[model samples]
Target: MDGTPLILTSAERTRAARLLARFTDSYENSLTRRPIAPDEDRETLAKLLAEPFPEEGLGVDAFFADVVDRIVPYTTTIAHPRFLAYVQGPPNGIGPYAEAIAAVLNQNCNLWQISPAANVIERSIMDWLTGLFRLGPHSGGLLTSGGSGATKDAITAAIADRRTDFRERGLQENHAPLVLYTSDEAHRSVVKAAALLGIGLHNVRTIPTDDRFQLRVDLLMHAIAEDRAAGKEPFCVVATAGTVTTGSIDPIGPIADLCAKEDLWLHVDGAYGALFILADSARDALLPLSRADSITLDPHKLLYAPLEAGALLVKDMAKLRAAFAFSSTSSYLTAIDDAHLLDYMDHGPQLSRSFKALKVWAALRTFGVGAFRTVTERCLSLAARLGEHIADAPGLELMNPVTLTAVCLHMPGRNAEAHAELLTRLHEEGTAMLGPARVHEQACVRACVTNHRTTEADIDLLAERLIALAKR
Candidate 1:
């Protein structure tokens, strides 16, 4: 096996080009219009995949054709404008093309020597983001897979920054019972991160939220005091800029003040709403985000990059390096040559990284930052319109305030199961794909207008259909 053939023949190269072209054409065409359900048999897919690996390869063209005919159909139509299910959106126009180019380059972006332009590009991107938050030159961060990974990494850094012995000894070392606090309205990622760090799910305190769905600052303060009185150390507080369920923002100004008074690390999960920092109305409000020690944002969610692009920014670059630069013991390569430029490996947990920055940089360059701002503003306005429509319609009630792009509504008399059915019907009818929400322990449907392609007509159509259903 070690002495096997190492090079591809001309036949294989031609076949590969044909196959790649076929799939690329298919993907490009689908993005031009609404995604309709494909009329194809799914059973044959299993049969095709079940066959053993051929002794003689199918070459490139056949493999590519099969992907076009068999694989693309089963994928979710996430790029469709009507896909308003979760806090997700269609990729920006340049995202796909940039991704393809990045694949061809195959730059291992972990080191500066391997990815000189990429290192500078990523740094420039991070610098621009830090400037948005009003963070000083000392601030720096790294990109992660998604918001979940960012939050986990931030919390890990917070633990290390606060605890003197956290480097060699983990949470189990002191057993001093350090506690972390977050609003009940925060995304579940916070709880999951704590549990992963062995912080004990029981030790993570869940503060209650107010009527507007914002984290209650008074309740948070009270909880911290009680925990301290009970002999527990309160070291960090995780706040939200845009929550998952209702898109409500916690009071960042007051949260920051409290963290400063108590000497606690403050981490803001701004994955869903941070890019709204581009929105003019939100720019002033989010200024307080600069006070946070760390922040999490997802380029995939609001920046309209393709899947799996999240970031974690820290006010102090040294803190980020101290938290993640543990596994630097590599003897296989020349270490000095890579250290001249910022090695992304020292910035995050992963070593073998991909050129994820290319797609993000491409989208920003092709469309410009102002374009994203307009779309974000449009989404917020669309959601506000949705909330108003729900309030005016009979039998429909606004479940939560329309703060960002998520608009949740509850039908007073409808059962939870019935609401789920309505969601299914809407998707089946090609109207839209919405998700269900449990607000105030009552069943409801949620519409997240995160797509740049959505229009006022789309918002009105959704409300009109729902009102008609309720009246029936």
Candidate 2:
């Protein structure tokens, strides 16, 4: 702690509460009318880069003013009703309060002793996830920065399972180069994870997908057999529960079976699509995810917890612990795990973690799981509504089957540049912020209905506008 006191007085604290309420009310009120993607503020950016800390403190009032005047205007409103550009979720009503409380508590959620309540909160969330996926007994996981980090850690666990001496030998021993397999449409993070773990990109096989954009199980088996013939040690298969581009789900059951036969660790990167299992419409398609050795999820996406909350669940908790556990002898650093609680530091790479689970838990408790189930199901319905419009419209093509909440559409003769122009027009007109997409190497546009605030009318508006643009 610093020698100079930074504590607020009772009067200041009361004023701070008033300021927060005013800001939230003002911001929320302006959201519907303001543009989703604000234009660049180069002047503000330059000032921010050049400015240094002041010798005198800028009190809470000035800080709030700066946020309201300078920061909020430039930031992209990710919570906007039409923010379907990426797989992002808006914050739930209770999450911001939970986040505030978590910050006030300042829990270093890495150990049980220091953050007993946090440990239980995180464990409880993971328990619900494990049971939801039906990963069987002795399954557990931890929250990471997001889906990318979770994927990286999942691969680390896979490598450790491949070689018992991985932690000790560090891949220096005499052994064939490890191979990782994934569909071409799998998230780029999987490739990055393999490369970072010293699994050469050459050994990472990009298996082809079927017509539905699902990984072709027959081709995967062929690739594994070819790798085996070449004396390559195939270690893991990364499958997608919901692929990013088209929301296509790979045949999880088939991929899991192949992994089982080949003795490869099966990891489902369910970052985009897995949580949809909460919705009845999506549950049957996602149920096969349970067979995987490990699964990645993002509560920040479907759960609508604040940003930067991703989780990785493994079939066996012991394997996960073995992969990341460190034996410490220092009295200050020593910790133990029990049925009631466990050290989160032993689950993943980071030692200093925030209390992300509180937001997730609080939101679940506040709104109830049934509420999110409705939101997800509604999102799926809205996407389908868009898909129907595209299919029925003239010169507009439904590029992919509306598998989840992503609807990819194309113009009959529009080139990549034309599609780019259309997206720019949408952004400029403040109609909606949609992302550009490609299907079969042909450019198109994709609208992902990940926001709970998005409605059937919003989808129809976008669809009608696209149809109008395609006419040009």
Give lDDT per model, in order: 0.85, 0.91
Cα lDDT tens digits for candidate 2, 1-472: 7565688878988998899989888877887788899759898889978899999888889989988887888889988898889999689888888989998999999889999999999999999999999999889999999999999999999999889999989876799989999999999999999888898798899999988999999999999999899998999999999999999999999888888888999999999999999999999999999999999999999999998899999999999888999987768878865779989888899989999999999989999999999999999999999999999999988989999988888887778999999999999899999999889888989999999999778888888888888898
| Cα TM-score of candidate 2 | 0.98
| Winning candidate number (TM-score) | 2
Question: For candidate 2, what's the RMSD?
Answer: 1.3
Error of 1 at 193 (Å): 0.9
Worst 10 residues of 2 by lDDT: 1-10
Candidate of highest lDDT: 2
Clash pairs detected, candidate 1: none
Worst lDDT run of 10 residues, candidate 1, spans: 331-340
Cα deviation of 75, candidate 2, in Å: 0.6
